[model samples]
Target: MGAKMLAEAMGMKALLYANWERLELAEVPEPQPKTGEVLIRVGHVGICGSELECVVQRHPRRKPPLIMGHEFAGTVVALGEGVANLSVGQKVAVNPFVVCHTCRWCRLGKSNICERRQLMSMHRPGAFAEFVAVPAENCHPLPDHADTRLGAMVEPVANAVHAVRLTGQVLPKRVVVFGAGPIGLVCAQVAKAMGAGFVVVVEIAPERLAVARQFADAVINPAETDFLTEVQALTDGEGFDLALDAVGRSQTRRMAVDAVHPTGVAVWVGLHDDETSLSGMGIVYGEKRVQGSYAYTDDDFAMALQLVVGGRVEVASWVQEFPLDEGVEVFWQLARGEARHIVKALLRP
Candidate 1:
């Protein structure tokens, strides 16, 4: 708090470019913590789709020249003035989305959706660098027995937890999820843990379909058959009690809507390119419900962490790791729909 602590390591390179393409490596700077902030020595940082989006085009919020990554697991290395109950070398998982708590959404117990919320990589410098400064209160200390990778994933897992938990109040009902990506796959597992009698996941890719099959009651490949037909067949033509769209495509979003039973809930968690056409009358006869879910609550993060730590859900099995330098290749492949076997990718700094 007295002075900016600059890392004096001569020529120690950290993040080259906040945008990966330039490969513009920058000199490592010792992070300075403002009041109530902590400088975390990041252990692991995951490359996410949001980071890819920022890199792929003109990011509306990105100021660039900053490191890119939101998911991070670290040890508290330094604390700002007035920080308490925390010590150096404390292992913790950061809630990177720093929210302006004075907002309306924050007051409604939805701070994750706060209008002024600036997610780590987008608004603040992120974990793509060696260290990141975040609010001390945003971190949750890791359990002694938890895998450190699980800590880095708490952020993304929170999204999956929110998407699944918002479906309905029902228990022990059939559920179908579209696109077995990380979120979709995780949502499938969460739904089952929340008492879905049978959780089905649909993926067009053979590799992803196989991965989903490992944890889901049924995995349907739309490449070989009509997805809507397959979903109907699995749900016995009554459609699933709940349907979740994780791919974010117009067709898949509609698929999630169409796959739900009469009066069932359809949760849209996907972000897609095109606006989809849906039948208004289609939902009228069924009394189906559709809604979009964003970010997550602290409770969702806690539940997702517990599931991973308790061995009730296996995230490690679906994970793939990539070094920071491989950022460009990874994003290109992911953008082109490559990396079929991978549900999640970890970017190590």
Candidate 2:
């Protein structure tokens, strides 16, 4: 039978991004795998902050009338032809970013920046439904001892892994991360895990700062304290060895650079605004390295899976679970900033 016929027989429901600020829950054809692909019965899908930007029409490349969930975990239900390694019923996580292996960037071993890369929800349908089909290579099997729900966390944590990895060798003795959201918190935890002597998190939200306190060496609220002064006090005026800005705003981006020592490294991981300004003279004089860390590399992805599977990182502390049917409401709530304490959200279809 065809895909539409199979979906009708199975009765699948999907949430589609119909238009800006508009999402519709509809019964759609269950996706069937083609050659070298596999069908996954989605167990959990993470709602990314970038998706929230999509809803508000802030993301430059995101177009409407598509399925939007990318970070997800599921069980393999069926394998397409030529796919022999992944067995049905195996738990897995989706990498979401599919690259054309023939691209120059791919040939250079920088597939994360492949010129022809296609991402789920950006170039193809995604896992915001009861079922999703992806290339067999995109599925990473989760360990039998790991929590399947945590599979949804791999992509996000992988982002942090890539960011921290960009900072180079010699782990910082004191690290300062701006923003206490999901990415910020993960960056702090990853720094601590990598043996950073001290990890400090800066945020304006009290609720988020409260959660930041759970894993960071110090959580400072810029709303209540003089942020630069406090950071100086914490580092004894020498400045942090490494600074990460996960917020990506002008002010926080400036803070990420300013809070670091003369030769310290600063990495920007968030994708909020297109334009930001900094002092070129200061950058030249201070000899600071400011780098932009994009999506994770293949090795970073595998390491992220290990991080989650080993229970070294706790995601439940920040995620708020919701049924797939509530995806529309969840998007609106997050867009309006009403879901305060929910640093991350997962949709279980």
Candidate that scores best on TM-score: 2
Q: Estimate each model's TM-score.
A: 0.92, 0.96
Instruction: Please provide, for model 2 over 306-330, each residue's C-alpha lDDT reduced to its tens digit, 9 standing for 90 to 100.
Output: 8888877778767888999998888
Candidate 1 lDDT, 1-349, residue by residue in tens: 2333224332234554444444354666666779999988777777777666655664667666766678888889899998997888898888887888789988888887989888787777788766788899888888888755878887777788888778656653888888887788788888878788898888887778888898799888777888778876887788888888888888888888888888988888877654877888989998989988988977787787777777767788888877766755775677566776566888765
Predicted model with the maximum lDDT: 2
Given candidate 2, what's the lDDT at residue 28?
Answer: 78
RMSD of each: 2.5, 1.6
Candidate 2: segments with Cα more than 4 A from true spot: 1-11, 58-60
Residue 69 CA displacement from its true place in model 2, Å:
0.6
Error of 1 at 68 (Å): 1.3
**How many pairs of residues collide in each model?**
4, 0
